[model samples]
Target: MAALILFSVTVSVISEKGEPAADLLRENVEALADNEYGHNIYCLGYGSLDCPLNDRKVKVITGEY
Candidate 1:
């Protein structure tokens, strides 16, 4: 018999340049669309977040408001 185990995690980051980290991250995922879980990061600047989350999705909270 054989089995496979897979897991995923979310990380928080901040970028002070033209491109936000989340956007870049999404783009990077695009490269691996074939095997990507299609994670989404919603950056809500200082607001109550009620994002739909699952094992493959995470809410990105920010304090820029």
Candidate 2:
């Protein structure tokens, strides 16, 4: 689930950038994905490893990008 969302975002974001920046974004998104599973790491926010649970569901909260 999460991986699916990220894959789409990665493609769209990188596609817009030049090779160098795109490469960097690819690496960052790859690091976020641990495996084939949809699982994702919780990015530390403002010195804490937490964000509102609602924030995690980007798709449901916001319309298609």
State which candidate has the highest lDDT.
2
RMSD of each: 16.7, 13.1
lDDT of 2 by residue, 2-65 (tens): 8659777768776678533456666766777644233343433344232333343332221121
- Global lDDT of each candidate: 0.38, 0.50
TM-score of each: 0.22, 0.28
Q: Which ranges of candidate 2 are over 4 A from the true structure? A: 1-7, 13-21, 35-65
- Model 1 weakest 10-residue run by lDDT: 1-10
lDDT of 2 at 2: 82
lDDT of 1 by residue, 1-65 (tens): 01111111222323333434566555555554543233543454333454333333324643322
The number of clashing residue pairs in each candidate reads 0, 0
